[model samples]
Target: MQAVIIAALVIGIPLAIYCVCTVKREEIFEEGSGKNAEVLDDDGKITKETTMGRIIKMDKGMGEFLMANGLHCVTCTSSANESLADACIVHGLDADIMLSKIQKYLDENA
Candidate 1:
């Protein structure tokens, strides 16, 4: 019926668009990326793992965590903007060594 067709068009279009977008997004990237990818440091150590649709997050509040690993993130206002490797360099530490430990902690606790 004309009414049925109108109703279907209104509801079905959005659903169809959503499905298309989802499929296209998936097809563009390999599976196990995005929420499923395991992040690693320069040393090839596992830094964080995704869980229940979330990647394990790091905290910058812990001075010990930052300094012990030689990140120097605790001092720099730009630290939040820096990546692990950059943070290590700014702090005058070996990024590979520091990141290896950070990755190890993240993996063990994650």
Candidate 2:
């Protein structure tokens, strides 16, 4: 029936797109999977060089940490290119303290 066909398409198309995006994200971001991959190191902590967008995408806990630290710019346009240190500087936060907290959180959760 026409209704069945429409329902199938409505559900199927987005599901297909979601699958594709998920695969691509894994391929691109998985440790050493691609050039400039956003990977956790042997210590399982993000480096100061890690970008805010990568943190938001790869680790929700770190993203939450950023949010709690007053870097609400996590979702802002400039976040894509901003490192943790850069964000801390922009927000007038202590990068060393934030990094230590983040590292401790990752260690405990790991």
Candidate 3:
């Protein structure tokens, strides 16, 4: 019927769009959250698995902590390939403590 087709067009189109958008958003969230990624080690340490630049991009507060702890490398081009633990070691910092601080911050905000 004409009424049925009109109703389907009015409702089905938006429903389909919403479903597609929701799926896309979920995919983006999964990638950003690093669900199955190697962001952390088996011992729960932030190791060379993830780069400092990626961490900084995840949270600006984390970036501030890096700078406050004398890690100016976050702004350097090499930072893209520099792991958090490597940066901590190069700056004479304890990577475990730094990772703890960052985890705490994320937990608190989350």
Which one is best on TM-score? Answer: 2
Q: Per-residue alpha-carbon lDDT of model 2 for 1-110, expressed as tens digits?
A: 99999998999987786676555444423332112233566655678777766765654355556678788665454566788889889899988888787767655654
List, residue by residue over 1-110, the lDDT tens digit for candidate 1. 99999999999996786676445433323222322234444554433221211111332223445545554344333233355555555667776676556555555544
Candidate order by TM-score, highest to lowest?
A: 2, 3, 1
Pairs of residues clashing in candidate 1: none
Off by over 4 Å in 2: 1-37, 41-44
Clashing pairs in 3: none
Model 3 per-residue lDDT tens digits across residues 19-107: 76556433433344322235656865455447875666555455556678677665454555787788888888887888777777666
Instruction: Give TM-scores for every candidate, taking all chains together and pairing residue i with residue i.
Output: 0.41, 0.56, 0.55
Where's the lowest-lDDT run of ten residues in candidate 3? 28-37
Query: How many Å off is the CA of 50 in candidate 2?
Result: 1.2
* Overall local distance difference test of candidate 1: 0.46
| 1 or 2, greater by lDDT | 2
RMSD values for the candidates in order, in angstroms, are 15.1, 9.2, 14.4
The better candidate by TM-score, 2 or 3, is 2
Q: Model 1, 57: alpha-carbon shift in Å? A: 3.4
Which one wins on lDDT?
Answer: 2
